[model samples]
Structures are given as structure tokens and as C-alpha cells.
Target chain A: MKRMKKALERVAETGFFLCAAAAVLALALIVVFLVAKGVPAASKIGLWPFISGTVWQPSAEKFGIAPMIAASLLSTLGAAVAGGLIGLACALLLAEVAPRALAGMMRPLIHLLAGIPSVVYGFFGLMAVVPLITQWFGGTGNSLLAVIVILSAMILPTMVSLAETALRAVPAAYREGSLALGATKMQTMLRVTLPAAKSGVLNAFVLSTGRAIGETMAVILVAGNRAALPSSILDPVRPLTANIALELSYASGLHEEALYLTGVVLLLFIVGINIASHLALRGGKGGR
Target chain B: MRKILDALGYILLWLCGALSIAFLAVILIYVLSRGIPGVNWQFLSTVYKPGLGLTGIRQIIWGTLGIAGLTLAIAVPVGVFAAIYMAEYAKRGRVLTAIRFCVESLAGIPSILYGLFGYTFFVMQCAFGFSLLSSALTLAIMVLPVIIRATEEALFTVPVSYREGSLALGAGKLTTLMRVVLPSAVPGILSAIILSMGRVMGETAAVYYTAGTMAKAPQTVFSSTRSLAVHLYLLVKEGLGAGEAFATATVLIVIIVGLNALASWIARRMSQRFTGGAKT
Candidate 1:
């Protein structure tokens, strides 16, 4: 009976090991499959032209993605800067200024915002944000500015929560020290606690930037799907993600392969961002 | 100058907080005002008739629930066991590092890439076609990292004394983990499941291609179907059914809010139970 029980334990251990390894296997499969399918198309189109070509005429096999690349970069930068500032201020309010009761009430609401679906955000953006932009700023409501506004809103919850956590993680002693040194409450918060928590705040910004870049569906609805470089903020522009989603369905043959190649480009951007976030996190550990 | 700077700081913080709240209020008010009128008994209960113009989202609701259920069913066991291995068994080593890296990478990859992968690997290579099975499989992979992280955190919180006590009683490693550690971690696991359910319900890009946009109810797991989020997207994309689109978006938001509340309630109740019992 003891031997039988031992055998069962061994089996369970092996089973758990396999389960743990599933993540590695899944990641491997995704990278391998995407590269395998996308490489041939990239090779045919030539890497430089595929990435730098301004025209996206699939009929003539012209598949440059310069415009989409520009749109993605510009929108991500705009959203991250806008959202990061607001998120930092909100984090300060929640972590330092607000009473416990009020902060408690607001946290869950923020989480609910985070839970709102991207498609719903898209629909809301089209009906609410787009029209406001059109009425005030002119051009079609669907433009890069609209995409930036929607994405900033979409990423706000993540940014606030992360930055709040970072702020809270600062030791109480830091604030006490500042107070003992005759620093005013606001001055202590801005100087001692904030500086100590700087790395964590930066980490929040980096991760939120990743979220903005990865956002697709909401961007699609508001970005106007125009595969052209925007001369101004109101001009409609497609990001790399929008390009992939808009054409993936009807695409066949080379068109399909090119879309997969777009996926590859987007994947590389996310991977790079993740690496930067990883570095930021590690740097935080060392600073502490 | 110093006083002025402090005043400006306070004003900025208050303005930022109010702005965040304002954004939330706008979305909620707009969606509810436009959508609540359309969400009636017929809209909630009746079947969809695409050609005849009767756009009840009953089938899509079932499709969303079905996908969520199936995806959770597949993800939970694998995720729990994986968390167990990492928390209870694994030590500092290269293998563990690799696993952690993979989990992080999985968490960061965009949902669209998951969609493309599901299309190529599950729908085509595995010959599952555009069906619920394929979509769930893809989502199962996507949510694995979330479940693993949450469960690992829970497991870490389980006091070492409990495991030691079980082992002293001659319970094997597996038995101790199953009886002591897992029971203690149930609340965390439950919350994680609820969170993943919300995500699975709200997801559109990943599910769009894997689960083909068939307007009718799926007869089997293999049958192509449309989730509520996807249905809303299609409605909005086609631009013909404004009322239906708002109603669908409203339904999705309601379900998400419900799930969020349920998760927080469970977490609060569990903590209260622990603290209240400890006093005795």
C-alpha cells in the first residue's frame, strides 16, 4: 500500500510539472508559427520596402507599412504622455491625499473601468468622443486625435492602479523623516516620497505604454483605417494593428501573408517594450 | 513662490482625480442612456432573426457564456497545477527562470497575435475550423498566465506551518497540498476565475476569427458562433443597427460590472471571515 501511494505521488508530481511547462510550450508555438508564415512574405517583399514602403496596395503587391508604423508610434507616444501625467496625479490623490473611505470607494470603480470591453470602448468612442472632436476641431471625428483620446482613457485605469501601488510601497519612514526635517506635507510628498518611489512610477509608465501600443479594436473604430501618413492630428491614420485586423478577413494569398508579417512587426514592438519594462523592474529592485 | 507651488500641486491633483471620474461618468451615462431603452424583455429573451430584423441577442449571450465556461474549464486545472509546481516544488534554477519568462511573455503579447495564432494553428493546422473549441483553446492559453500568477500569490500566502503540520501527520506532499494549501487558496483562485471570466466575455479581437461570426446559436462546441462582444462589433461595423449595437454594448458592460462586484465581494467576505475567526 505504501509503495502504491508513493507511485501515485510521483505521478502527480510529473503531471504538475507538465502543467507548469505548458506556458513555455504555448509561447514557443506562437513565435515559431508566426515567424514561419511571415518570413516568406517578408523575404519576397524585401524587409526594407515592407517596413518603409508608404503605399499599401496589395493588388500590385506593394506592401509598405511606413504610415501604419508612424501612426502607431505617434499615438502611443501621445497617449502615454497624456495618460501618464493624469495617472500620476490621480495616484498621488488616492495614495496621499484622499481619505481612506473615499479611496476605497473609488478603487473598485477604477477597476470597473478597466474591465470595460475594448469593443464597447470603440462603440462609445465613435458615438461620444468622435463627435465631440468633430464638433470642436473639425475634420472627420475619426482621426489620430480620437485614437489618442480613446487609448489614453482605456489605459488610465492601469496607469493609476500601478502608480498607486508604487506610491503606497514607499516606506512610511520616508515621509516621517521629511516631516521631522520641517518639510511641509505637500513638499514632503513631492520631494522625499516621490523621489524614493520614482522607479516604481517609471515602471508603471512603461507598462502602461505597452498597453497603449497593444490596443487594437478601439483604435480601429476611431483611427479611420486610412493607410496614409497623417499630415495633421485630425487626419485619419491606420496603425500596424488596425492594418492587420481590417484586412485579415478578406485577405488571401500574398495579402494574407503580408498581414501575418504585420503581426510579426507588432509582436516585435511588444517584445521590445516588455524588455524595457523588465529592465525597469530589475532596476527598481537594485535601487531598493 | 513655495506657497504658490504647493497650491498648484493640490489643484493639479484634484483636477486629475476629477477628470478620471468624469471620464468614467461620461462612458457610463452615455451607454446606459442610449442602451437601457433597447434592452427589453424581447431583446433579452427572444432568438435572433438576422434577415427578418428581429435582433434579439439571446443566442449571442449563450455563446459568450459557453465560451467563458469552456475556456475556464480548460485553463483552471492547468493553471492551478502549474502554480502548485512553482510555489511548492520549484527552486531557484534555470528551468524556473525560463518558465517565469515564458509566463511574462505570454502576459504581454497582444490579443491580436493570439487571434492570428488561433487562426493558423487551431483553425487550420488542427482542423478545428472556426469554432468555439478553437476560440476557447486560444483564450485558455491567454488566461493561463493570469490564473498562474494569482494562484501562486495565494499559495505563497498559505502559512508554512499548515504544510508542516500535515507532513508531520504523515501526509504526503501531494496530499498536504491538496488538503491544506489548496483549501486556503480557494478565495484567491475563485477571484482569479471571475476575473478571467470577465476578460473572456469582453474579448473581441482574439475571438473574432477563432469563433466565426455565425448569428445563430451553436448546436455543438464545434459549431461556429458569435460572442456578444463580437456581435456588438459586427453590428457597429455594419453601421445599420444603431439601437441594437448600443443594447449589445450595454449588455457586455452589465455582465462585466456584475463579475467585478462578485469578485470584490468574495475577496472582502473571505478577509472578514479570516479576521473574525481569528478573534475567537
Candidate 2:
């Protein structure tokens, strides 16, 4: 009976181990497959002209991903900067100033915003924001500016939640010490609290950057699918995700592979950002 | 001077909150106004036609449900088990640390990259041939991190005393986890499902590659089908049909909102029940 019970226990333990191992293996397989498929494409294209050239013409067999890369970077940077500042301010407000009731109400609403579908945002941008832009700016409804606005709105919830969490993590003693030295609430928030929470705030920004750079549907609808660099914010421009989504269906042979190469570039960029943020947090912990 | 700064800070914070609320309101209003009037029983029941009147989104709806369900089925057990391993079984070691890093890294990778990976591997090599199964598998991969994190959190919240008591009564570890820990963690697991559902519903890029855009419902697991998100994208992009897209968008929004509310309510109810049980 004892031996039987021990055998049963071992079976359960092995089953649990296999379950965990399978999940990790699945993730590893994805990364390996992406690299294997993307590398040959990158090698054939010589990497430079494929990523740096501005024109993408499948008919002519010429493909350059420069515009998409630029648009992605520009819009992502815009959203991160704009959303990061607003998020930090909101976090400070929630942490320091708002009454408990108000904060409680605001917290879930913010989460709901985060939970809303990106496609819904696309619909909103198409009907309301696009018209507003076209009427005022005298350009096409779909442009880099439209992408920026929608992406910023999409990223706002993430920024707010992360910043709020970080701000709350700041020790109460720091605030009290600053107050004892005759610092006002606003002054303490700006000098002592903000400084203490800087790494966390920075982490939030990095996370938002990842969101913006990879955003697809919202940006795709607003970005106009043009393969040229934007002369102005209102000019139609394509990004990596949009290009892939638009062309993935019919793209054959080299063109399809090149598209995968674009994915590799994007994956590398995001992985680099993740690694950097992890290192920064680790360093911050060690320093403390 | 300090008074003015403090006032400004308060105003800015309120304004930010207002802006977030206003954005949600604007979206809901626009989607409903444009979409709701066009929604009819016929529109919800028929397959899409390119040139004819606005056909139903029934096929896409089914496709969406099929893919989302498959993703949930694939993701939930794996994620929960992995989380249990991480929280309860794994020792603090280099391997565990590496797994933690990988999980976080996976979470941060963009949906677009996932699409790229899916297309290259699943569509091209795995020869799944751009079917619902491929898309479902990709989505399962995409949501793994969210599920693992949520499950770990839920497991962590299970009181240590409960486990101790169960063990003292001679309940084996597996029995304790299956009978006690899992029931207590139901709400957390549900929240993860809700979150993953939202992601799957909204996803366009990832599905676009692995699941080719077919107007009809998939005939089988191997058949191609369009999800509501992919359908919406095609409608808007190709300028094929406007009213149907709006109607579909409205339905999508309603479903997403309903799921979100249900998730929150379940979480609250579960916690309340746990508290009530603890008191006894």
C-alpha cells in the first residue's frame, strides 16, 4: 500500500513537471522558428537596403522598410512622451490628493479603459477623430498624427496603472521627511517623491513604448497604409505591423520572407527594450 | 506660490481622469450610434457578401468564438500548472530565474511580432495552412504570460494555514491543490480568462497571418475563417461595407464590456465568499 501510494505521488509530480515544461517549450519553439525563417530573408536582402529603403513595391520586386520603421518609432515616441507625463501626473494625484472614495471610483474606471478593445478605439478614431483632423488640418483622415493620437489614448491606461503602482510603492517616510523640512505638497511630489519613484516611472515609460511600437489595429486603420515617409504629421504613412497585415495574404516567395524579416527587426527591438528595463530595475535594487 | 502649484496639480489630475473617461464615452457613443441602428437579426445571422447588402457577421462571430475558446482551452491549464510550479514547486535557482525572465520577455513582445512568428512558422512550415487552429494556437501563446501571472497571484493568496491543515489531515499535496487551492483560485483564474478574451477579441495582426480572412465560418478546424476583428479591419480597409462593420463593432464592444463586468463581479463575489467561509 505504501509503495503504491508513493508511485501515485511520483506520477502526479511528473505530470505536473511535464505540463510546466510544455509551456516553456512552446515559447522557445516560437522564438526559434521566427529566427530560422527570418535570418535567411535578412541575409538575402543584405539587411541595410531592406530596412532603410523608403519604397515598398512588390510588383517591381523592390522593398525597403524605412518608412514603416520611422513611422513606428515616431508615433511610439510621441505616445510614450505624451502618455508618460499625463500618467505620472494622474498617479501623483491619485496617490497624494484624491479622497478615498474618488480614488476608488477612478481606479476601476481606468482599468475598464485598459480593458476596452483596440478595434473599438479604431472605430472611434475613424468616425470622430479622423473627421476632426481632416476638417481642421486639410489632409487625409488617415495619417501619422492620427496614429499618434490613437496610440497615445490606447497607451494611457497602461501608463496610469503602472505609474500609480510605482508611486504607491514609494516609502511614506520619504514624503514625511520632505514635509518636515517645510516642503509643500506639490514641492515634495516634484522633488522628493518623483525622484524616489524615477526608476519605476521609467519602467512604466518603457512598457508604454513597447505597447505603442507594437500596436496594430488602431494604428493600421489610422495610418493610411502608404509606404512613404510622412512629409508632415497629416501625411499618410505605413508602419511595420500595418504593412505585414495588409500584405501577408498575397505576399509570395521573397516578399513574404522579407516581411518576416521585418518581424525579426521588431522582435529584436522589443527584446532589447525589455532586457534594458530588466537590467535597470535590477541595478536599482542592488543600489538600494 | 505653493498654493497655485497645488491647485494646478489638482486640476491637471482631474483633467487627466476626465480625459480618460471622456475617451471611453466618445467611443461607446460613436460605435453605438453608427452601429446599433443597422443591427438586425438578419445581419447577425448571415455570411458576408462583398457587393450585396450588408450580410450578417454570423460566420465571423462563430470563428471568433471558436478561436477564442480554443485559445482559452490551450492556455488555461498550461498557464495555471506553470504558475503552480513556479510558486509551489520550483526552488530558487538559476533555472527558475531564467524562466521568470523569459515569461516577462514574452509578455513584452508586441502582438505584431507574434503575428510574424505565427506566419513564418505555423502558416509556412507547420503547414497548418492558415486555419483556425493556427490562429488559436498563436493566441494561446500570446496569453500564456497573463494566465501564469494571474494564477500565481491566486495561488499566492491561498492561505498557508489551509494547506497546512489539509496536509495535517493526511491529504496529499495533489489532493490539497485540486480540492482546496483551485476552488479558492477560481476568481483569479476567471479574471485571467476575461483579460485573455479581451485580447483575443481585439487582436487583428496576430490572427491576420495565421487565420486567413475567409468570409464564411470555418467548415472544420483546418478550414480558414475570419474573426470579427479581422473582418472589421477588412471592411474598413477595403471599403467593402460600412454599416455592417459598425454593427459588428457595436456587438464586439457590448460583448467585451459584458465580459469585463462579469469578471469583476465574479472576483468580488469570490473574495466575499472566501471571507465568509473563513469566519466560520
Candidate 3:
């Protein structure tokens, strides 16, 4: 009986170990497939023309994605800057100032914001944001401005949640000491606590930027998909993710490869930012 | 001077709070106003036509449920077992660190890339083609890490005392884990699985590649099917069905919010259960 029990225990333990390693297998598979499939296409396009050329007329056999690259960066930066401010303010309210009941009510609502599907956001942008932009700004409704607005809203929940966690992690002693020094409630929160949690705030910004840059569905709906570098916020522009999404279903041959290469570039950006944010978040925790 | 600055700061904070709430209100109000009128019984039960884009989304809704069901069924047992290993079975060492690293990077990988991978690996190489099974597999892989992380946390929340108490009563290790530990951890684990299902339901990009764009209910797991999110995307992009698009969006939002609330309530209950008697 004892031998049988030991054998059964060992087998179950081994099974769990194999189950735990499933993530390892999945990651390896993704890396292998992406590289084996993506690298050849990117190389065939010639690195310079692929990354630098502004024109993206796939039928003409010209596939420069620089304009799309520019649009992606521009909108991502816009979202980070705009969403960062609002998110930080909201985080401060939730973590530092709001009544417990209000904060409790709002926290899950914000989580639901994160839970809202990208397509729903896209629909909202098309019906609500686009028309508003056209009325106020006098250009096509689907433009960089619409993308920026939608992306900012999309990133806000992530930004607020991370910032709130960082703020909550700040030791009570720091706030107490600042108040002990006769600092006003607002002043202590703004100066002492904010400065202390700045690294975490920066982490929030990095992660939010990653979200904005990689965002595909909503940006596609609102950004006009014009394949041009926008001269202003109101001008239509196409980001890299949108280009891949819009054309991949029908695209074939070099056009197909070009879209896959576009995915490669996007994966690079996401991987880089994710690594940076992870490091920043870990470092912030250690420092705090 | 200090008083004026302080007052202004307070006002700014209050304004920020109101602004965040205002954003949610605008989205909900706009969607409900536009979409509620379009949700008649006929709009939901009939199949959509190619030329006539305003028919019911019943098939699309079924496809979404089917894909979500398959995803949860595959992902839960695997993820829960994996999480048990990480939290309870494995000793702390290099292998543990490697698994942790995998989860961290996997969390940040974007959905579009997952779409691309699904296309290459599932649709082409395996010859699964554009089918519900392929999409379900992709979604299962996409959400596996999330469920694993959540379940691992849940497993850790089970008190060591319970396990020891069962062991002290001469129960075997496996018996103690299955009978005593998992029961207490069920709420948290169940919540995590539900949340994963919600993610699979809302997923557009990952499934868009593998899930065929067939506009009707699938005949089988191999049959091509359309998801609600992709359907919503097509309706708006095609320029003819803006009204239908909003209605689909409303349904998607309602389901996603309902799932999120349910998962959160379960999570709250789990926490309360461990601390004291069930208060919620």
C-alpha cells in the first residue's frame, strides 16, 4: 500500500510539472514560427526600402512603411502624454483622496474599462468620436486626432491601475512625515508622495505606450487607414498594425510577405517596451 | 498663497475623478441609446445575409459561445495543474525562474502577433484551415498564461495549515490537496477560469486569423465561424450596417461586463472566505 501510494504521488507530481511547462512550449513555438516566417519576408523586401521608404503602394511593388511607422509613434506618444496626466490624477484620487465607498465603486468600473473589447471601442470611436472631430475640427472624421482620443481612452485603465498600485505601496510613514512637517494634504500628495512614486508612474507610462502602439482594431476604425504621414492631428494616417490587419486577408505574394514583415516590426517594438517596463517596475519596487 | 494653491489642487483632483467617470458615462450612454432600439427579437434570432447586412446576429453569437466554451474546457485543466505545480509542488530554483520569465513576457505579447502565429501554425502548417477549432486553440494559448498566474495566486492563498491538518490525520499528500486544499481555493480558481473565458469571448485579433469569416453558424468544430467582435468590426467597416454594428457592440459590452462582474464577485468571496465566514 505504501509503495503504491508513493508511485501514484510521483506520477501526479510529474504530470503537474509537465503542465507547468506548457507556457515554455507555447513561447518557444511562437518564437520559432514568427522568426521562420517573418524574417525571410523582411529580408526579401530589402531592409532599407522596407523600413525607410515612405510609399506603401503594394500593387506597384513599392512597400516603404516609414509613414506608417511615423504614424504609430506619433499616436502612441500623443496617447501617453494625454492619458498619463489623466491617469495619474485619477490614481491619486483613488489611492490618496477619494472616500472608500466611492473608490470601491470606481475601481471595478475601471477594470471593466480594461475589459471592454477593442471592437466596441472602435464602434464608439466611429459613431461618437469621429463625428465630434469632424464637427469641431473641420476635416475627415477618421484622422490621427480620432486615433489619439480612442487610444488615450484605451490606455487609461491600465495607466490608472498601475499608478494606483504604486501609490498604495508607498509607506504610510512618508505621508505622515510630510504632514508632520506641516505640509498641506494636497502639497504632501503632490510633492512628497508623487516624487517617491515617480518611477512607478514612469512604468505606467511605458506600459500604456506599449498598449497604444500595439493597438490594432480601434486604431484601424478611427485612423482612416490612409497610408500617409499626418501633417496635423486632424489629418488621416495609417499605423503599422492597421496596415497589416486591413490587407493581410487579401494580400498575396510580396504583399503578403510585406504584411508579415510588418508584424515582425511590431513584435520588436512590443518586446522592447515590455522588457523595459518590466525592468522599470522591478527597479521601482526595489528602490521604494 | 499656500491656501489658494492647496484649494486649486483639491479642485483639480476632483475634476480628474469626474472626468474619468464622465468618460465611462459617455460610452455607455452613446452605445445604449444607439444599440437598444436595434435589439428586437428578429434582430437576434435570424441569420445575417450578404447583401442585406442588418439581419440578426444569432449565428455570430453562437460562434462566440462555442469558441469560448472550447477555450475554457482546454485551458482550465491545463492551467490549473500548471499553477498547482508552480505554487505547491515545485521547489524554488532555475526551472521556477524560467517559468516565471515565460509568464512575464507572454503577458505583454500583443494579440495581432498571436493572430499572425495562429495563421502560420494552426491554419497553414497543421492544415486546420480557418476553423473554430484553430481559433479556439489560439485563444487557449493566448490566455493560458493569464489563467496560470491567477490560479497560482489562488493556490497560494490556500492555508498551509489545512494541508498539514489533513496530513496529520494520515491522509496522503494527493488526498489532502484534492479534498482539502482545492475546495477552499475553488472560488479563486473558478473566477480565474471565467475571466479567461471572457477574454476568449472578446478576442478579435487572435481569433480573426484562424477563425474563418463565414457569416453563419458553424456546422462543426472544423466549420468556419464568425465571432461577435469580428462581426462588429465588419459591420462598421463595410459602411452599410452602422446601426447593426452599434447593436452588436452593445451586446458584446453587456456580456463582457457581466463576466467581469461575476469574476470579481467570486474573487471577493474567495478573499472573504479565507479571512472569515462567507460575508458576501
lDDT of 3 by residue, B45-159 (tens): 9888857654789999999998998888888888888888988888899999999888777777788888988998999999999998899888888888888888888888898
User: Per-residue lDDT of A1-288 in model 2, one digit per residue for the tens?
Assistant: 877877987787777667667666776887787777777878887799898888889888788999989988988888887777777777777787789789888878777778767776776787679889999988888888888889888888888888888888899999999999999888898898887887787888888888888888888888888999888889888888788777877888888888777777788788878876877577657756
Best by TM-score: 1
Q: Write the per-residue lDDT of candidate 1 for residues A58-102, one digit (tens) a residue.
A: 998899999999999999999999988898898999999999899
Give the alpha carbon lDDT tens digit for every residue of B1-280 in model 1. Answer: 8889989999999899989988999999999899999999999988888678788998889889889999999999999999999888888899899999999899998888999999999999999999999999999999999999989988887778889999999999989999998999999889999999999999999999899898767789898988999998888888959999999888999999899889878767666655664632
Minimal lDDT window, size 10, model 2 chain B? B271-280
Structure candidate 2, residue pairs in collision? none
Give per-residue CA lDDT, model 2, range B144-226, as digits (tens): 99899888888888899889988999988887888988888889899889878978988888888888888778888888888
TM-score of every candidate: 0.98, 0.94, 0.97
Interface RMSD of 2: 1.7
Report the error of model 2 at residue B100, Å: 2.0
Native-referenced TM-scores of chain A, all candidate models: 0.97, 0.96, 0.95
Higher-TM-score candidate among 1 and 2?
A: 1
* Highest DockQ against the true fold, candidate: 1
Residue-wise C-alpha lDDT for candidate 3, range A44-142, written one tens digit per residue: 889787999888998898999998999999999998988778888999999999999999999877777898898888889988899999999888899
What is the iRMSD of the candidate numbered 3? 1.1
By the DockQ metric, which is better: model 1 or model 2? 1
Per-candidate fnat, comma-separated: 0.81, 0.64, 0.71
Candidate 3 global TM-score: 0.97
lDDT of 1 at B193: 95
Misplaced by over 4 Å in model 3 are A285-288, B50-54, B277-280
Model 3, CA-based lDDT:
0.87
